[model samples]
Target: MRDLNVCIIAFSSTSQSVNLYKILKNKKYNVVMIQTPCTISAGCARSIELKEKDLDAVVNEIKQNNLEIKGIYRRVLNDSTRRYYYSEIDI
Candidate 1:
């Protein structure tokens, strides 16, 4: 099966997630605010979703902005089973 080129950034605060979303959007990055996946335990229920290709740039932006993040995760979808598997990414 093919993998979806998506990554999620988990934050400990909702405000931080929204702030990052706005920052990325303003920079013309395709990002979305989504509910933090159950697999990830975070203080905030919200997270930022972006393409895997943009992961490096996003992380750099986060560093530059001094934003706090709980963790980063990459999601893999099984086409045959229609299930999603998540793996934590070490940044």
Candidate 2:
């Protein structure tokens, strides 16, 4: 499968984002998450990225766990700007 560089999993609130961030971090998904960037604003206070494959399972778990998800955005960064791609899975 093609590799996915950055995946943004956004939550509905800082508290929610924190909790999800902790859970995902502990699970160790080769992706980095940071506080919500100025470019995007929503119920989420932060965003996370994991391998494309991990997206489905993570989202499922988040749903089962009752974690609020604002949205899941897929992005590809090149020379200067970032491009957005819609995804049902993580990548």
Candidate 3:
């Protein structure tokens, strides 16, 4: 199978994460609430997950609303090794 690439939006606070989840859900975006990965230290335990293809739109939504975020990341899951790799996304 092909690798899966996901976009992770880390928030400074749990409330911010949940608020963004709500906003995205209401806007009909496919998103999920997730625990922040240990590799990312800037955010709280809660974060938001979405498809990599939606990253730009999500980022735009965040900016248009002036929501604060700790950082953004691209997570890739290797199907063969069953390992996940993370990289910070510049925004």
Candidate 4:
């Protein structure tokens, strides 16, 4: 099995999602902007993906920058089922 790295940032609005994406992207992380996955919902229609190792910094940026975050979720994709397990983060 292979491991996938991602961070699902649930924002209060699409605009906020875009802002978050910009901030993360500027940090030069492997970021991908996408809609909230079908199987998960933290109240955001948009999300950004980054390396798992960068999760802490990203979370810190959001908090430090006072970004409005609905929630942040981590996931381990079930390769066989091609689905993600939504889980919370302590940060």
Candidate 5:
């Protein structure tokens, strides 16, 4: 998949990432824990990555549960250059 896209989320704290990871996994959301991308300034090294199609439900659930998310990013490959399309969720 040359231009594959996926949804990514970062947290300020590892605990927060871990907690949200558990919540999403328990709910049967296809997800994987990954390192926070450098494009975003999340202090924590850990993050959650899931399929792009899961964005709406995952984002809604995160907001509803009051997860302190650093930000959300869409991993996009454009012209063979990888870039992160970000959205600030928790201010």
Candidate 6:
């Protein structure tokens, strides 16, 4: 598969992850819950994608709702292998 670099939002609890998805979806954010990729160590089996520009807003929302998140991640591509790699984001 080709490299798919993306910013993903992860949670510690599956229910909380899905709940955030519903909230973001209702707000019309380009978010989707998917099976957690092994590249990133998270607290749940499910994860969601969030836009970079929306990071601050999403963070606020998450905090306002008292949701605990594992962290954000950036999916990077290994040029030599042309495979995807995951890197943890401080935010």
Top candidate when judged by lDDT against the true structure: 1
For model 4, residues 1-91, the per-residue Cα lDDT tens digits are 2355666766778887788788877877778888787666746678777777888888788888888877777777778988667676666
Model 5 lDDT tens row, 1-91: 1424677888899999999899999999999999888777638999999887888899888888888987787665555455444554342
Q: Write down the lDDT that model 6 would get.
A: 0.79
**How many clashes in candidate 4?**
0
Count of clashes, each model: 0, 1, 0, 0, 0, 0
Clashing pairs for predicted structure model 6, backbone only: none
- TM-score-best of 2 and 5: 5
- CA shift at 26, candidate 4, in angstroms? 2.0
- The whole-model C-alpha lDDT of candidate 4 against the native structure comes to 0.75
Estimated TM-score per prediction?
0.90, 0.67, 0.85, 0.78, 0.80, 0.84
Candidate number with the higher TM-score (1 or 4): 1
Q: Report the candidate with higher TM-score, 2 versus 3.
A: 3
The local distance difference test score of each candidate is 0.91, 0.66, 0.86, 0.75, 0.80, 0.79
Candidate numbers sorted by lDDT from highest down: 1, 3, 5, 6, 4, 2
TM-score of candidate 3 on Cα atoms, chains taken together? 0.85
**Scored by Cα lDDT, where does model 5 land?**
0.80
Q: Per-residue lDDT of 2-62 in model 2, one digit per residue for the tens?
A: 2255567776677877777777777775657776554556445677766667777788768
Question: Could you give candidate 6's per-residue lDDT for residues 30-90 as a string of tens digits?
Answer: 8778888876763489999866677788888888888888888877788878887777878
Q: After superposition, how far is residue 19 of candidate 5 from its true place, in Å?
A: 0.7
Ranking 2 against 6 by lDDT, winner: 6
Question: Candidate 2: which stretches are off by over 4 Å?
Answer: 1-5, 78-91
State candidate 2's TM-score.
0.67
Q: Candidate 4: worst 10 consecutive residues by lDDT?
A: 1-10
* Residue pairs clashing, model 2: 12-43
Q: Which residue pairs in model 4 clash with each other?
A: none
